[model samples]
Target: MSTGRLIAAYIFGSVGRGQADALSDLDILAVVENNLGKVAELDVIKLVPLQFASLKPSISWYGAARVAEMFQNGELFAWHLSRETVSLFDPNKFLQTLGTPAPYKECLADVRSFRAILSGIPPQVQQSAVNAAYEAGLVYVCLRNIAMAASWELCEAPDFSRYSVFNLSGLRKCPISVEEFDAAMHCRMASQRGLQPPHTATVSYILGIYSRLDPWLDELEELLLRKENGRQYAQNAV
Candidate 1:
């Protein structure tokens, strides 16, 4: 009840879409007056464990002023929360006071940035399966955002789903397979929730699949970046 420095919090992602399963973890954006240095977060979460056990929440922190800044900057994540979020805690209506965010306009650039991060995965996975969970987690997040950003850029319905990369289609078939996608997703969730890492067999499987991951990043990159019939990419759709 006495949540110090916490301004507001909201639920988003799968739970936001009304499409969560036992496997899905709750995603929370906790808008705080300021970030509690990392060590204090462990102490604060000890405040409410049982209540959040079933949902297995993953909380991302943002300073209240930072949230306002993100809105002003027209960040995709700001728009994402605006569209698909359910307020969990807000005594002062901090988010409501912020009002609508500026339009999202930098999807292609974001996609390119995430793709660059993914480019390192193949070499890392090739070196050792010990980091398979980390490598798979990278692929999962990077590819998911790449798809989401591309959707926003193309004037398509934005999908913030874990499987959005696979969900996106029409221009080219998804390079990620269902099984591969699921494996990577589990790795990410496990890392996010500090749960047990993936099984040895899963690590091996992910490693095998990753050797091919880089080759297709180039493929999907082109598809996402292509201009359709000389049309300009969408801007300010939100």
Candidate 2:
């Protein structure tokens, strides 16, 4: 139960990237030694110093050996930890020892993860405008990740800013406005805070955003397809 047992900890996601806003949560990963069973019993809030109480941390616990295995296997989650983390505690430099992740492979994994999330959305959840708006916001975030991956393949830096994908010249060909997209994102945050916008307005905004994103999704799928084909070809030739 002692915090002293933790070998390493890291802050990641928006906080690690220095992009936190009022609604952002602190995403934390803690590595421990020989206490995997005790993880569930630990009080995470108590482990966090009182100074960070306002940050609303979401914590995940992992054993040191498991983390090392994940890094060696090129798991996307481990890759993210290696690439986008600010070490809170690293007496052993465990995070530093992880090899650099393959960006293309990470991007493809993210695309698949996002697609799974979208596909898992129940039909009933979309019945409410607020719910639809929230779902649309998730979709927009996923699209941004897809755009970043695609951009990386083209030798461009990955842009993680919200809705940055819509600003791409290629995506500008699709019919969507900044205002409409913004509303969907706004509606999502507001809904979480228990403030719902008009149902009709929310639904309209979400529909518009989705319609515009459709073709872009198609393009992303094609990009992944090409990457997979090339990877298979290379493996076959070898």
Candidate 3:
């Protein structure tokens, strides 16, 4: 794909927000002027410098029109773009014109996304250290999303750090010890960095934490569902 077709590009997530740690990966969003269809033809690796290749880029592609629509609809992507992203390339300044989305809408979207992930989790993760670590990280992300949504609803800035989510005041107290959560976060960080796989102890600790957290996850889901239903009812009554 020609670079001329690119409308804008941004770095988001931890790195963009200046909260990245040693293990953070790069998240890049490329908005193209034309609808390139479902299959992305652009090779991101070819665009970055050779030295930065080791930092494994997680690239997301979208059409310019789709991004504009997302901004108009107050969608999660638009929220991130407006509030959390650092624009790297934008000759036309396309992203500068967009406004930050409503925090409540973003919170609801986070709840919905978390619920979808929770619904898809397998009853038993495969018996491999890597698999176990990956599953544990997935659960951690789901819990973090719940905490983030709650924080946003309260008009507080949502922090994506593991420490913030694990210590969220309104969240049910984590049954795992602080050491255990630390181990899980380390395991996740290592996995993301493509380092050595998690050890058996790390895997067991994370799984145990997940097992204990199941009920809390259920409660969180129920609360979100009730809030959504209430919103619908209020809309209808109006």
Report the number of the highest-lDDT candidate: 1
lDDT of 3 by residue, 1-238 (tens): 3543667777788777878766667788888867554334344445554544566588888888888788887665576677777766778888877555544465666776785775454444634553776766676667666666655543356555445555555446656666665666665666677766456434556556667766766665566567778988999999
Q: List the residue pairs that clash in candidate 2.
A: none
Where in model 3 is the C-alpha error above 4 Å? 1-4, 36-55, 102-116, 119-122, 126-130, 162-164, 177-179, 185-193, 200-203, 222-238
- The Cα local distance difference test for each model comes to 0.72, 0.63, 0.65
Clashing pairs in 3: none
Question: Candidate 2 — which residues are off by over 4 angstroms?
Answer: 1-4, 38-53, 102-106, 109-113, 116-130, 144-178, 187-201, 231-238
Candidate 1 lDDT over residue span 46-124, tens digit each: 4333645587767788888788998899888888888898777778988778788887777768877997887787677
Each candidate's clash count: 0, 0, 0
What TM-score would each prediction reach against the true structure? 0.77, 0.70, 0.72
lDDT, model 3: 0.65
- Between 1 and 3, whose TM-score is larger? 1
For TM-score, candidate 2 versus 3, the one ahead is 3
| Tens digit per residue, CA lDDT, model 2, 1-238 | 4433577788888777778788687888988885544344244445555555688788888888888777776655665686678877777788877666443366666666776665544342456644665676565566556655555443344555565555443433436666665665665566666766535344555555565566666776676678678988999999
lDDT of model 1 at position 132: 80
